[model samples]
Target: MTEKNPSQKTVSSRQNIRKWLLIISFLLIPVTIFYISPIVAMMGAGKGIVTSAILLYILLFVVSLVVARLWCGWLCPMGAWQEICSPIFKHTVADGWRNWIKYGVTVLLFAMLAFTFISAGGIHAVDPFFGTVNGISITSFQILMIVVIIFLIIFAAAFFTGRRGFCHVLCPIAGLMVAGRKIRNLIGWPALQLDTAAGHCIDCKKCSNECPMGLDVNGMVRQGDMENADCILCASCADACPKGAITYGWKKK
Candidate 1:
């Protein structure tokens, strides 16, 4: 009977809390749908109105320009849903075709949205409740069906591809944030990102194993190149590292 290594066994309180937070966010989708709905964004664009979801997308882009993809790790209900389904398969998603999917989606969706907005005359009004049912989502059977199918797609993505598959493969929001992060990197601005002290690493590999995004945190540390656009700055690696080799902060990277 061999004991499990602490590095292999430990799931830190920080990560547990983050998982719970994301789960809670998922549960709150009914109340939050209008604020994050991609469909609403398109509808709003066509109406020449700025919807909550449209504003949210803009905010997400701006925030990512400052802090990378914190929204993906912190408050995205879709991300939370993926986290819930990831454990069912418990594997890394294929990094080939799937990884490029979001980029294409982002470009196509944004182009269509921009076209609609421009054709519709652009920014005529602002409506936080653009497509909501008296300020709440899921107000009808038809709406419920659409919502269910969206969630089902999210579920299928994670179950089949494993570990935040929708995020890597199909999230337009993720594509937006990735673009923002790239811009930030190019600008060399002070922003929120992971910092590493390679000298402090002892090659435990716990950081790599603990990442919910399936990132190579250990490799990033060893290479001293921690500025990955995919990194959500969730700090799971920071919490998992016993030697405090990895941390997150606001600085030029």
Candidate 2:
């Protein structure tokens, strides 16, 4: 009997995990909004929920620092929605330029904060997801429904053009999460690499195909450069490697 390739097996495992995570997020969203949205509203109304909301936000921030946007990948409802659309539009390209959206989102958030502190407290109205979800009454959520439709459409376009572009570029929560990851040493940064003759990589290009980001994973592996900021630590490249030589770890200091 022929032995199965380890790299292919790894890729399959990672893809399975991604699929299951997406499914779990779909099931978890309603409960999350039911439990958390009220607390947010109460906090805004100065009804003692302020402390609870603050605590919750802090806890989430700490979690982000530790896991580096893993929540965005695995738990966020919008993320799950986007991932569901990814496979439907398969023409993707790696566009590192899209990272510029992070800076724009940061600026926009600060602008909202300034407006909230100085003028009418309407910052929440501008957050697309928040606005969409809470804009109308539960019985009359046409606006929110429309927003969802638009979001799904845009996500589908991005997925077909470039997978996960929405999260990498357009999502404000992801911007915040990425910032938190940069400022903290509390969470260990996961690094992926190979231990053996990395330079021998023949550029078979399987890793890039497997990567959600459409990154040159094979090139990075050849250069032993696993610490690239673009790396999501999903281990897709390791899964796609035909050679069992690919691995992930802390580089020797």
Residue lDDT tens for model 1, 80-153: 88777765758877657778888999999889888999999978999998888788876788888888899999
Question: What are the runs in model 2 whose C-alpha is more than 4 Å off?
Answer: 1-11, 33-57, 93-96, 114-147, 153-161, 184-197, 249-253
Where model 1 places Cα greater than 4 Å from the true spot, the runs are 1-13
Candidate 1 weakest lDDT stretch, 10 residues:
1-10
* lDDT on C-alpha atoms for all candidate structures: 0.83, 0.55
List the pairs of residues colliding in candidate 1: none
TM per candidate? 0.90, 0.68
Please write out the lDDT profile of model 2 over residues 1-253, one tens digit for every residue. 3334556765677669877987786666543442324224333433212223333445556775655566665556666776676676465555566767756875675454444434544333312123224432232366347446656765854664577766666654555556666664344454222343575556677777876666777777767765444456566666666664466444331
For candidate 2, give the lDDT. Answer: 0.55
**TM-score of candidate 1 relative to the true fold:** 0.90
Q: For this target, which candidate reaches the highest TM-score against the unseen true structure?
A: 1
Q: Compute the lDDT of residue 208 as modeled in candidate 1.
A: 86
